[model samples]
Target chain A: MTTHNKIDPLGPGYEGVAGKELRFRDVFRDTLRAEMNRDQDVFLMGEDISGGFDRDTKEPLDAWGGPFAATKGLVQEFGPERIRDAPISEAGFVGAAVGAALTGLRPVVDLMYFDFVTVAYDQLLSNAAKSRYMFGGQTRVPMTLFARSGAGTGHAAQHSESFYSMLAHIPGLKVVVPSDPYSVKGLLAAAIRDDDPVFLVNDKKLINLTGFVPDEDYVIELGKGRYMQRGDDVTLVGMSYTSVVCEQAAVQLADAGINAEVIDMMSLSPFDEDILLESVQKTNNVVIVDEDTPRASMASEFAAVIADKAFDHLDAPVKRVTGPHSPVPYNKGLENAFMPQPEDVVGTVRNMLGRD
Target chain B: MEISKEKLEWMYTTMYRIRRFEETMLEQTFKGNSMGVTHPSDGQEAPPTGVCAHLTDKDWIGSTHRGHGHCIAKGLDTHAMMAEIMGRATGQCGGKGGSMHIADFSKGMLGANAIVGASIPLAVGAALTAKYKGIENESVGVSFFGDGASSQGVLHESMNLASVWKLPVIFACENNGYAEATPAWYSVSAEDIASRADGYGMPGVVVDGMDVFEVYEAAGEAIARARAGEGPTFLELKTYRYHGHFHADDPKKYRKPDEEEHYHERDALKNFEKRVTGQKLMSAKKLKSIRDSIEQEMLDAVEFALESPMPDVEALYSDVYVNYSNPIFGLR
Candidate 1:
């Protein structure tokens, strides 16, 4: 199912500049620095962000003392005033960011890891997401909440679940889950500049993955999907880190003489439905893969929608490869069984192909 | 402090309005004439009114779920507010946000949040914006939450941040002795919520929440200090919830038989009447006339709400997105 076709995703007839491979963490820091350098309104706030160095001492080791080092060296460049460290209060600081967004400053708040979002869900959903609408267009919350999500590493339950779908359920929130370094830099830069509140979910696994990105700053428009691979047999729509899994499965499916198109849905809310529709219409079949639990997952929502819109065009019923409807287990093997693996994606593609 | 006759009359009238409005709302809820959640500000009238009494149009107040009193005190259109509580189209927020989320930002009434302890930082943020924008007049913000919210991490963090930045935010804790079903005594681990203000290096005060004059004086000092750029203040308003946390709930099991009656003995309205009449600040007849006018206004508000039409079906998705020009996916 791995079919390589030339597609101009940057634009028609306009070839964008490309650079050497860059790590996802470096991309985040570089993109944040670039945006902050360009716009003074953009600032970073969270626990240990300003401290950047020593963790055990909890003192200002140098600049970036954040646990993840995602905000490394930001304090020195922007100063401690712009790069603030709160007292481990996500709800307070994040809610204050929402309030700040409504007034003037474009704050980029970090939750360290995605699991800490529970402490601030009320602010994220009720306050930031609903502020513009609740105020009857009197205000706008242009804040960005960046957090590391997913559980490839043994971080356990509190920090592992991909709750992107939960946020997508809310109307005003824009959820961005970038799978690679290239998309991370572009999409994060975009999220920081977007007028709406964006929940940018970064995967811990992809933080070390390298990809080619532009030397200069760039912006990837929100609500648009990028087709990573082109095929004619079946359209495969993947989200976040799961998109990488789809690519691997596509390779395996190719060895078995199957061709599948892959579409990486970077932004979950206000999804690029047109891309999904166009891909499904071209392939005449669809397989949706997601890392989230199958029940009420984004894949389920996409499948239902594609079935309704492109049912007549389809040669086979849509299939979804997602995590089981159970908690992500603590054991590595059990957790692997619970999550959607590349082999599961290959099996799903085979099943969909067999149905035709 | 010598209060003017006009101010005394206004205070009396404000208390009467809150009492009558909550009474009417309780009646509506009892008769099953309401829509969403309702947490009456029945016994907690004096905190909102007392604090808001000193606020001008430039200042802002972030209220709690029990916020009808705050809305009224902040000069919200009673007819529209009442209409919103009934989920009518003519209400504030166009009936989209009901009792727990009523808001009129133009009047400096930042929407009443349903989530506990959520609005404290919002008020601090707004105060920060006011200070940063360099508004010529010193505009401050007030955050009104329950005693339960003091236990929330946001409450403590926000107070610290406000102090660190010296933002013009007044943290008003309405210690009604209970947060829903949980008593503050069991939940709060501090001597008093205000006592923690010292850790944040801010002035902490306790006031008789039922006494309009006491709350008024305390709030006035804090507001003046904040406006002068001195810093934030923590005011713990000690009051008692005379009604059930919400309408149609049983408070009988939670309190002694005469607990409500005992608190009612120190009714804010009665206290104001005794003080003003005894001091000859305002005539009892003059206060009665104001009350009569407010009662008539409330009756008219009820009429307006009842007569108002239900929101159109299209309104369900109207305010969901601020600039959502196209709703391509209309499940309805």
Candidate 2:
């Protein structure tokens, strides 16, 4: 998903950019700071974003800087007024975020963990998502919400989740999944600027992974997926961390004398179906990988789209490497089994190619 | 609490407008003109009329299911409201939102939410915006819910958020005594919902919903305090609804005869008329003229709604998002 400095998403005439290697957490924080500096209306609200307040002075301590410290050092720079910390009440704050967005502000709320979205699901789905449509286009809820998601972390069932399909299933809301440092930078900026409510699901696995990030203010368009590697043997589709899994599988399969093209569907809800379809149309074999549970997953959705639109091009039936229809456990081996790994996609691709 | 001659006239007209609007809307609902369920806010008119009387178009208000009164008080056109109830393209929300979801963002009326206690945070959010922009004196947030919504955790959450941030918000809880068929006595844990405000650390006042002047004065104080950066306030307006929860619901099934009689005897509109005429703040003839004018407005609203056309099929897909990259809604 890293496109490098040559292609600044701020688009054209702004080239000669420098590059640096940074962790996803740093990129997330830097992007927040950049957006805040760029737009005065942009503010943040989340539990533990500022971590703690002094007993007497009530100054932000930035103790934890939120889970994974994704928002570290932001409070000190933006001040507590702009980088506001919220209470444990998810529904209350999320609802307030929607209202704030409606009333004229770009509110980015850190929902902590993806699984915690259920607590405030009504506000997200009912007000933030549906307000514009339901109100007959009277208002636009320009809200951006993010949270850590994925099963590889030992957060157990309550904290680890990739149920973005539940959000993607919604009509009005937009859902984006950034794979690495590069994707997070561009996508976060884009999500913040987007007028509609966009939920960016940050996989916990990618938070610590360092990758190439351009030293340019840019935004990768939402609903667009880029080709990581182009091959004709099979098209491997991935989103969020699974994109990383697909890239790994593509490398492994290439070593086995098999060529596979990897497509990272950055935006899930308004998904980059064309990228998947085009890759499938050319490659004739496709394998969709996802970390969410199997039933009604994004992998299945991509498979369905491929099957429906590119049936003639398919030399083999579309296969999916997805998490089992079970909760992610805390056990190391069990958690590993629950997520769609590089080996799983390699095996599924091999089976589809009849080369195993 | 001092009432000016012009302000008194506007209040009287606004209350009468709400009263007639509800009655007319119900009549249209029974006449098979309304597309969906309609929640009549006949008896609980004073809460919105009083609170909104002090508000300008810059101030924001979040409303509940029974939101006709709030819409009328917020300066939404009756013609569009009627058309919306009738599910016409000319409605406030282009017929997409029925009676429960009509909104005019230009008027700072956050859409009327259908889910109980769902719109509380919206008002708090609006106040957050005002406060964020450092415009508290010019804009404030007001949340309108019923006794049914008093128990919702979001209400408590919103109150705490407003008080902590000292956002310019007013938590206006209309204690109409019934959430659907269940009475507040059975559902509400507290003796008075306003008492819960103490826990949230905001001043809580119980007002007579039947008296427009009382609601107006109390709301004025709260709104002023919010505008003055003093923080949020909780107002429990003791009110009642003349009709059932929805258009077809019959109150006789759950409510006792005396309860209905008691509320009707102390009707908000009747008391407003009596008060104005008794104090010589307004004349009986002037009040009658306002009533007569409202009667004609109701007739025109109904006629406009009946004559309006249904929305195009494409409208179903339109307005879903400001800009969705995907063109088609259905499957490939």
**Candidate 2 per-residue C-alpha lDDT over B152-216 given as tens digits, one digit per residue, 9 for 90 to 100:** 88988999999899999999999999999999999999998999899889999999988888999
Task: Estimate the overall C-alpha local distance difference test score of candidate 1.
Answer: 0.81
Off-target runs (Cα >4 Å) in candidate 2 are A1-17
Considering the two chains of model 1, state its CAPRI-style docking category.
Answer: acceptable
Q: What is the lDDT of residue B50 in candidate 1?
A: 83
Q: Cα RMSD to native, each candidate?
A: 4.5, 2.4
Write candidate 1's Cα lDDT for B229-250 as tens digits. Answer: 8889999999988877888667
TM-score of chain B of 1: 0.96
Clash counts for the predictions, in order: 8, 0
Give residue B180's error in model 2 in angstroms: 0.2
